[model samples]
Target: MNLLLNLILQEKQRIDYMLERYQEELAELPKGTIAEKKVNGKTYFYLKYRDGRKVVSQYVSKRNLEDLQKKLEKRKHIEAMIQSLEEEKRIAVKVLEG
Candidate 1:
């Protein structure tokens, strides 16, 4: 039982570490126009235009950049949690079998 518990704990820790790494990658995404907008306050962030038509770069705003950063952080945290849980499960299984 003690071995099982220890395995679960170690697995959880490993998962958490992987998740943190994933989040870090997300946070490091290159800065660019992720979206666009039009006159009249209408947003058009998904579509990209090369010439003609007014298009606002979504990543151009400081607020958007900040929001992205926050999102990245939040995602990273969640991922870490998920990894930890998965590792725990794996370790539990191994211990139970052995």
Candidate 2:
């Protein structure tokens, strides 16, 4: 019971962090993967993502790749945190039940 309670608190904290980031820090970030293609010895970048069932691509300049990468990494981190919180919640519930 003690362990479960602690786990619950930890999960709550993480969820709060995720929400705060999503609302303030990363609110304007578009969802996509940074994809690169090379043509005849030159490299070009694009932000690739899915729209329903179709794969859409948005062009990105070389100068913007670094910023895009940072946003992508931050988005991934937030997603991982949300997943972790969900798992923790499930485990805590099971522990309390059994």
Candidate 3:
């Protein structure tokens, strides 16, 4: 019983550390989606996102579109990870309390 409690405590510590690190990483990641617009037989890409109460759209050059898309996808993956970790942490706390 003692060993199990120790393991749980260690796991809780690790989760806390990882949650902080993931949040910091998330803050640095870009937040937006790629939107394409057609004009005069040509397609242009834009990065669209909300800024406060207003929506902002920034034009994205073709050369940078792929890189931007990858970053946005990475941000989404990190968000999912953060959510999972939060749930895990909540469970860990409940177990520790009992």
Clash number by candidate, in order: 2, 0, 0
Kindly report which residue stretches of model 3 are placed more than 4 angstroms away from their true locations once superposed.
Answer: none
The residue pairs found clashing in candidate 3 are none
| Alpha-carbon lDDT of model 1 | 0.57
TM-score of each: 0.38, 0.68, 0.95
How far off is model 1, as Cα RMSD?
A: 10.2
The residue-by-residue lDDT of candidate 3 on 1-98, one tens digit each, is 88998999999999999999989999998898999999999999999999999999999999999999999999999999999988999998999999
Writing each residue's lDDT as its tens digit, candidate 2 over 3-95 gives 767777676677666656655654576788988899999999999999999999999998888998988998888677767766766665665
User: Per-residue lDDT for 1-98 in model 1, tens only?
Assistant: 79767766677666667766666664564332345457588643432324455653333454465576565456556666767667666765676567
How many backbone collisions does model 2 have? 0
lDDT ranking, high to low: 3, 2, 1
Please list the C-alpha lDDT of all candidates, in the order they appear.
0.57, 0.77, 0.93
Query: What value does the lDDT take at residue 12 in candidate 3?
Result: 91
Best by lDDT: 3
Q: RMSD per prediction, one decimal? A: 10.2, 3.7, 0.9
